[model samples]
Target: MDWSSKTVMVTGATAGIGAATALRFAEAGATLIITGRRKQRLETMADVLTSAGANEVYIHRFDIQKKEQIAAVVKNITADTLSVDVLVNNAGLSRNFSPMWEDNTDGWDDMIDTNIKGLLHMTRALLPGMIDKNSGHIINIGSIAGHEVYQNGAVYCATKHAVKAITASLRLDLFKTNIRVTSIDPGLVETEFSEVRFYGDKERAETVYKGFQPLTAADIAESVFWSASMPEHVTIAEMLVLPTDQASATMVYKK
Candidate 1:
């Protein structure tokens, strides 16, 4: 896969898996379009991407949860004549770790709006360009929760399951075309994920990975890169990545 001429768009590239994935492509000398809600963080990351050997780095600050914002960003990118060769849907999070009955609608709303609707909005906005060019790849960042549900995470799990369905259906929808759709579902990757889910409670987040070696953002980034770089004829439709200490979404070995 020759990345030198490719332009990859990654959502939520300010940190965590999104940042790592963008950096991975940057190392391959790819042009990167990084979008996130944090303007300062995105600006800071542009320099890092440039230093990492990205041919070019463009930062757009927008919250994916907003459909209008996603539309505007896509319009701007198109105006700049930047056609994204690959779109990595990674702007998603779990709001709270609580049972459905105990949780409020606020967390549920956040999870649904960002995880499912945001993904759909971005994909819908950019997919036409791919269809027109007849060349592109859509890699969705999913979770083990997509395949198996866990206790107290019903809503979050549902969002991921929606992602799984979207990926599969998109693949089928574009079967006749050259475009590829894939989902990279990972188990435990220690990032701001737990912290964010716990509402910035660092102590609670720390305990989630204390007893086992969890996957890193870069680990998942590598897998994402591999899946996207495959030959045009071959599509790595789905990849389920888990650490040695983890099996299912609930089965994690603690030492």
Candidate 2:
């Protein structure tokens, strides 16, 4: 694919996999639209992405958990007359590790609102343009948890499972169109993920990858880029990426 002429939009681009993916595309010389809640971080990223060779860089500051915020961002994109060639739904989180019976309702709500509802809102917002143009790609960042359940992660897993289902069903929904949909399901990745999940307990988060090499944000970014770069005739419907030391959500070879 000639990325130089394409415009890519990535949600949650302020950090983690989203930032890496944006940087990857920028290095390919693509125009970029990166959205996140941190205005300062977004500003810094825009400069960094531009320096990384993005043809042009744009940033939108908004909280994905709110539909109003998402709609406002979409309105701005439309007003700017920017047509996104690829949309990466990358903004998501896990609030805590409490099991279902003892989990905070607030945490549950956070996970659902951001992981599931946010994704739906963003996709619905951008999908019409893709359909109207009859050309586009939607890459959803899923997780290994989507395929398996684990203790104390029931709510987070449920959200990702929903992502998996949505991605599959969306492919069937758009089968007749020229548009493409893909899900990139990754295993453990060492980023803010653990810290966020553990509520900023850096010591606790560090132990999650103590004895083995977990995937990095850039590693997942490379997978996302590869999926997006495939021929138009080819659609990578789903991908499950894991560190060699990790076999499943709960099975980590830490030795």
Candidate 3:
């Protein structure tokens, strides 16, 4: 697949699956627009993408939770005469692990704002261009939690469920157009997700992956690349990726 003329925009490109996907697209010779809230990390990723064979690498720092910032960035990109060929909505986080009654309301806000609202903001800002051209692909980074619920993860699961709904609805709404929509839902991939969920408790985060060989950021990235690289007429609408030891969101086996 030739991505020489493609312009790929990835949110949350500072680390984890987002960073991996950016590099994957870079290797395909795409012009890259990588966004993240961390300024330094975003710049570093930009340098790495440039060195990795990206035709052009642009970095933007902004919180996806901020609607105005999303709009401003999209405006800037349009002014530069670049429309995204692929939009990877991967800016998301899990904040806490507790049952609904005991969970922090702040955690609920964070997950809903980032995982649900943030995804909406980006898609709203960029979908119009795709419609005008009648060409593009939107790959949403979802989780198996979207499909199944687990204890102490009600809010997080709810947000992902919203992602599933949004992805499906967007595809239906765009059915008349040539645009494609897909949701890449992974069961588990070792990343900063656990650390953030545990509020920087590194010890606890490490434990989540201690007994098993969890999926890596690169593994999910490969899936994203393949989905976007498929023929325009074909859309791998929804995918559930998990490690061999994992069966479902709540059914991971540990040795």
Candidate 4:
């Protein structure tokens, strides 16, 4: 199951699950194509992976919010020198929960654009190459929120739900092709995800993982590896991951 020369691309590669996943693939000897909008952070991550064991590492720094930029990135990556073996659409955004009718427009736009539209743009950009080769894997980082919505999470939930639906749709449409599509839906992960969603409110972000165990970035990273490493004939479709003490989105028990 060694990746040897296979090239894998991961967005949101600067940190969290994407960073961890990139490290895993790099260790397994994959040629890595890592991307994120953050410049220095992404460069530092590539340094770590290069030190680990990656054969060749390429970096693309671009904001997912810019659709044209995403297109340019795809062209650059797919140039004569590079071809993708796997594409992980890990870039996403979440927002604080607020009353739907009481002026939630700002959060709404960010969540919709980053979470939903951004993912779609990346997929469209990269899938043609995968289809041409008749082989590739796509691992999307979805959330339990996609399955069950909580208060103050209207737009976030909507975007994730859209993820769930799109993952299914893409799988169906690509049935004839050997491209693998998977959704790694994690319950609650103690990552920068919460801080961003809570708008840098450290306390509120910390509260999400209080008094209980939550999944970590490495946990989901291993899941992504498993999904990608499966036999060409097997696709792990959708996965729901939670800590042992958790049951569902709203049913986590914390002390």
Q: Tell me the spans in candidate 2 whose CA falls farther than 4 Å from its real position.
A: none
17-95: candidate 3 lDDT, tens digit per residue: 9999999999999999999989999989989999999999988899999999999999999999998999999999998
Worst 10 residues of 4 by lDDT: 95-104
Q: How many residue pairs in model 2 have overlapping backbones?
A: 0
For model 4, the superposed segments whose C-alpha errors exceed 4 Å read 102-104
Kindly list the per-residue Cα lDDT of model 4 for residues 1-255, writing each as its tens digit.
669869999999988889999999999999999988899998898899999999889999998878999999988886847889988889887876567886358878888888889899999998888898898988898989889988777888889999999999999999889999999999888889889887889999899899999988999999999899988999999999999879987898888
How does model 2 fare in lDDT?
0.95
Clashing pairs in 2: none
Per-residue CA lDDT of model 1 for 52-155, tens digit only, reads 99999999999888999999999999898999999999999998888778887798999999999999999999999999999999999999999999999999
The C-alpha lDDT values of all candidates are 0.95, 0.95, 0.94, 0.89
lDDT for model 1 comes to: 0.95
How would you encode candidate 2's per-residue C-alpha lDDT over 95-119 as one tens digit per residue?
7797678877898998999999999
Least well predicted 10-residue stretch by lDDT in candidate 3? 95-104
Give per-residue lDDT, candidate 2, residue 90. Answer: 97
